[model samples]
Target: MRRPSALRRLSLHRVMTHADYVSTHVVGRSLLVSIAAIAVIHAFGIVTMGVSSTSALASMLLAAGMLYAILAGLAVASMGDDLGQGYASLYLAHPLSRAEYFAAWMTAGPLVVLVAYLLSVAAPLIALNPSSMLDASVYLPVLCIAGQISFHTSVAVFSSILFKDKSKAILALLTVIIIAPTLVVFVGGLLASAIHTVDIMSLVAKIVGVFHPAVFYMPFTPRGGSASLSLAYGFGASLILYYLGYRFFKYRTDI
Candidate 1:
């Protein structure tokens, strides 16, 4: 089946290309398999590991941390070492337009990671305590991951486009994904709290609020801080980056 809405215009062939891209890559697939493996190991752990609040929380963090792998996979796997060689001639020569390529690559890129991440993180927590899903503390982390993944995917894709070299793109994606979140949530949030200046983190939080309809559950939000929205911001930021990346790849990438 074809993707819906705006993406419906993308041909079936393009969608298949995305599937092909995902199937052909080792990094994204391996990351997904590793996450699934963790869940599998936990599911079978009758004697070794026991589920508890701490273990559940650890799984949640592990799932959230999948954002790092998502970024890495999307940044490097989409090109399949094509971008690292310093040219897009092989892809550009294809029947696909640059826009089509980018859309498909992005449309299907992080989705794989998202599914694996959710299952990996949530499966363990649920197995440990089925009622945990009812707890905002448990669900909030999973919810936030959606937004976080989107944000990181866009960042990685943008980096991939910004730098033709694979390694450099991955580096840029990591810098922003790792450093930006800390600075925005921790540093910026802390500074805002100290001086009561502009709600630096709040502004970002407001954008991603959809990710966590209720914002106070996570540890990132200071006790008295402003809004800590995350999902909407992640989706919104991704949209902007996707546009920029596509535009650049479409016209300026001839270089």
Candidate 2:
């Protein structure tokens, strides 16, 4: 039999991605609640505190937190469940390869997160302060925030494939994103206290700043370069993890 053409395979992948989005739109609805919450909070700030760059930036980061917390695990749990339940085998039985299935999911999951994030942060901030649109400075932070969300999405997808179970994948993903960072800070604090010096906490904070998403919210600049270097790191690490997830899924995942 003739092999399927690359165009046909790509078309099938697109169709699969659309189907995943449709199926997961319920979860996407839940993301709307997050977006609404961000909008309401930002609106309240505008009413009471008035709009400022600080508040707008805070709201943007808040939206990123909400995006990571709400969608990360659930987005990829569907895939883990499919693998666990043998549903992936059904998909693989068709013209679709495992790589395409994985690609479809990776595309859909991030697409939902990105769209929800833009709605939650971008629309509200711009609407509240139309002048911000004229401000060239606003664009970089917005893109960086989106990049941060993409990083979280990659980690979540990798966790899902690694565990191959809904609950475990979600637990592991959240542990990495939230709990692990919190514990790092806590340890840093404890170490600083034990040493009777503030230096240890600063050192640990710097370490966390290197790897954790929490650092994205804070201000940091390396010796020579600007903060955009952090964005480069985030996107670069995400690509590595994304590929590792795909490799594992293609070679190791049974379904």
Candidate 3:
């Protein structure tokens, strides 16, 4: 006597609610601010430095990545506090699975970061010269930015879930802030040693070029070039961390 149609509709409705949780939390505000900041920087660079198309594009992408990483880090860190005691209790009580909640939280931060990337590059190009915007090179930078931000977001989410205590969470966030730059330096040194390049200055510059969020906004340097490998590494690391976080969240009680 009952129809399968109604059950399917209810299931779809539940899916929609879970997916929309991140958007409902206003994480997009961070992305909006990132866009505005990048636009201002682009405008200033053009006015002062006589920016070329390539330089402008690079700058925009760098600004977008840096801003999004910082903001997304902060947003994810405060997820628990923002939910409030009552809401947190209610969220735990809901029929939704822990994996679903974790996925939603993780997904929201990256989505905002992606939006920031688009706005950062698109707004500048639109304002300065729309005709020059369409190019294959542009996709490379965008992909790099997305991969970097995705990696950072995964770290932020994992840290958030791992540390429930406010003090501990803050410490974890600070560690993340510092470790990225340190890791880039170490990696650069290893690369330089392996290559045995005599040009110390060029080696130093190249070492600084690894696409970590900390030094992303630095001006033109050889180190900033050829980051596809670095980006891929970041993505791979993020996936590993995300999976580890999920397993821990499923069995652990302290979180």
- Say which candidate scores most in lDDT: 2
Error of 1 at 131 (Å): 4.5
Better of 2 and 3 by lDDT: 2
How close to the true structure is residue 62 of candidate 1, measured as C-alpha lDDT? 40
Residue 210, candidate 2: how far off, in angstroms?
A: 4.3
Q: RMSD, each candidate, Å? A: 6.1, 4.1, 6.2
- Candidate 2 residues lying further than 4 Å off, grouped into runs, are 1-8, 12-18, 21-50, 63-69, 134-137, 196-198, 214-226
RMSD, candidate 2, Å: 4.1
Task: Compose the digit string of candidate 3's lDDT tens values, residues 96-179.
Answer: 666656666665665655665566556655676676556645555666666666667667767766765434554565555555
The true-versus-predicted C-alpha distance at residue 219 of model 2, in Å, is 4.8
Flag clash pairs in model 2.
none
Residue by residue across 205-243, what tens digits does model 2's lDDT show? Answer: 556655454354343421222346557766777888898
lDDT score at residue 248, model 2, on the 0-100 scale: 93
Query: Model 1, 45-120: lDDT tens per residue?
Result: 4113434453445354544455445543554444535555644566557676666666556545666556655676
